[model samples]
Target: MRIAVLMTNTDESDFSNSWPKDGEKFPAMMRRVRPEWEYVVYSVKDGVFPEVLTGIEGVLITGSPHSVNSGDAWVERLFGLIREIYAAGIPMFGACFGHQAIAKALGGDVAANPKGWVFGLVEKRFADGRSLPLYASHSEQVTKMPKGAEVIASGPDCDVAGFVMGRGVMTTQYHPEMEPAFIAALVEHLADELPSDVTERARASLVKEADMQAMAERIALFIEGQSA
Candidate 1:
């Protein structure tokens, strides 16, 4: 499958060797789920994207450091592009920033969590009685949903941790692309951006192996238009 990976942010400046760029992270994790998938990455934060979505069967939007409400020109352009993709009936999957972006662009609301940053590993509970501990690192969440949006799963702190729109789009506020070690490294990288106590808890929550396989398969299922 040929997938368009819309990478919304660059890697942290201080830690070059500790981890890969945000764009690299997704493909690495996704290849385990769909090894045949070929990715074409666009740096959305740097204003890079295809002129059109022609021939792209699936679209994957990566997490970013920017907020969905930031109103940057690139973000505006991306919102418009998302509409185009949806209009064309292409399947799309979104991660952290992508989740909030998809929600906001589709007429939902995103805001700071009243409970504060929900960093580290979190158990997201699905309506079907299944729970998965996935890596999370976000302060904002989709509060009000857009038309046709359905919440499939949620966490204690973030209600709309996972959602879907029709069969064409699926999103999660957690990072399926991020491994536990990477989350720990990122916790240190983003120490100044969050409270020290939050960072400390995030550090403590790195014990579990991230339940990434199921989430990765979920994205692949959504992209391939199959049952979840």
Candidate 2:
């Protein structure tokens, strides 16, 4: 499959080579999921070419520092593009900001959580255990489920963790692409902002350490199951 990974942030200072640290971490995860597939990385922060998506088999929209609800023209444009992609019935998987974008595009709401942030690997109870092994570290969660979206997974903080609309459009609020070591790096970076309790909770959820191969296998199964 020709999969395009979209990078939405323009913060050059965020990490080395102008890519988010998690973006760099995900390819290793992808290799284990579909070794034969070609995965290309694109920066919407640079600009998006709608033509690049024509023959693509799948699109995985990565998390961003920016919110989908931001009053940016580019955000609106990307949402429009995603709407087109979704309409074409191409498989799309969105994480974090990508999930928020999916929510916004589908006539849902995105706002700061009144409960504030939920940072760590939260114990999410799925309606069915189809969405196990979720890894997330974010403050805002989707409170209201979008129209025609399935609430596959949920937790105390967010009622919407996983959602599938139509045939192949799917999203997860969790970061299956992020592992413990990666989250450790993020934790260190956000030390001041992250509470001690949150960090401890994340560490408790660590299994298999930072084995990208295993995480990739789990993610691959999840994606393939979506196709089935």
Best by lDDT: 1
Clashing pairs in 2: none
Tell me which residue pairs clash in candidate 1: none
Q: Candidate 2: global Cα-lDDT?
A: 0.69
Error of 1 at 20 (Å): 0.9
lDDT score, candidate 1, position 22: 70
TM-score of 1: 0.95
TM-score of 2: 0.83
Candidate 2 per-residue C-alpha lDDT over 1-228 given as tens digits, one digit per residue, 9 for 90 to 100: 777777674545654343345446566568866878777777775676456467787777878768777778888888888888878777778888888888888778777767656665566566766435556766776766667888777764777877788666677776767667566666666666667777666656564343445435644554565532
* Local error of candidate 1 at residue 214 (angstroms): 1.6
> Positional deviation of 35 in candidate 1, in angstroms?
0.7
The per-model lDDT (C-alpha) reads 0.87, 0.69
